[model samples]
Target: MRYWLLGALMVTAGASANTSLFNLLNTGDRVNPVAMMERVETDHPGYIADFELDVQDGELRYEFDVINADENTLTELTFRATDGTLILQRNSKLEADDHDELEAVKLLDRKQLRFSELVRMASEQHEGKLMGAQLEHDLGISYLEFKMVDENGKRKHAFDIQKLKPLPMLQWER
Candidate 1:
């Protein structure tokens, strides 16, 4: 009976070890730019931007820089490494105000925390005021933006923390 239980435990552990979120969510090894570009062009038509693919944090990621004909930043997009799914997309103009606020917040003296940690703290501290939160990265700066709605939903405050530095990107072998 003891041997059977031990065997069952080992089998279960092994099975679970192979079924991580990364494995379940990621279908492919990494995305190739040529392939991704082809797909992007076909899907988005004129909106697609020039992109580069590289390994970051042991995962494959695609970094795209889209500039309009007027030489203004339009959007910056990043795709996941394991799969080509879009992880982040930002419109430069739309984020301008948020970016400025984040920069100001970065100068504050609060203890640094991870994105998840900050969100947890904000949710706990603000409770009913907290709506949603997301980590925003722009021009190599990382910040957290929290959206809070008042009880009447008449007032909204988008709080930002600009000082929390982003984790360094992992170096990949060429």
Candidate 2:
């Protein structure tokens, strides 16, 4: 009987947490996550690998994990809940990839087009909902890989990072 009562209380508490989050969304205390992501991408340009909407320092905020265009770095960006103002931007290095690709990216100049700019061009031409993106060097060529969702499911877009030109869709060997 004690075990059963404890389990019931736990479930009730879980439901209350969900209700509070829902109420916050409905009452305009927080912005929609999807819209927030879109705005962030438009301004910063990176793959959003994760997101969290929670209270920080007693104030609500949205946190996002961004894999930058270089594909060798990760950035954590936190934004205010009420106005979508960026509160913080933190960066970290990624682990090494294939030797050849790693060497190629390292050898390339830093004057190439910005990652956000490449994404904007690809989005304009592809006409789909931008899902995520990353920079990669496949077979000694550096490219920006973007994933998009449309009526036909997901598709990949690869663009030349140096020239800022779109490349053919990669056919992955499944």
Q: Which candidate number has the best lDDT? A: 2
lDDT of each: 0.45, 0.62
TM-score of 2: 0.52
lDDT of 1 by residue, 49-145 (tens): 2344445666657665443323334567778845679888876652454443343333332343333345444444442333234444455554444
Model 1 scores a TM of 0.32
How would you encode candidate 2's per-residue C-alpha lDDT over 59-134 as one tens digit per residue? Answer: 7787876665466776789999788889999987755543333432343335543344555665578744454555
**Pairs of colliding residues, candidate 2:** none
Q: TM-scores of all models?
A: 0.32, 0.52
Task: Say what the RMSD of model 1 is.
Answer: 16.6
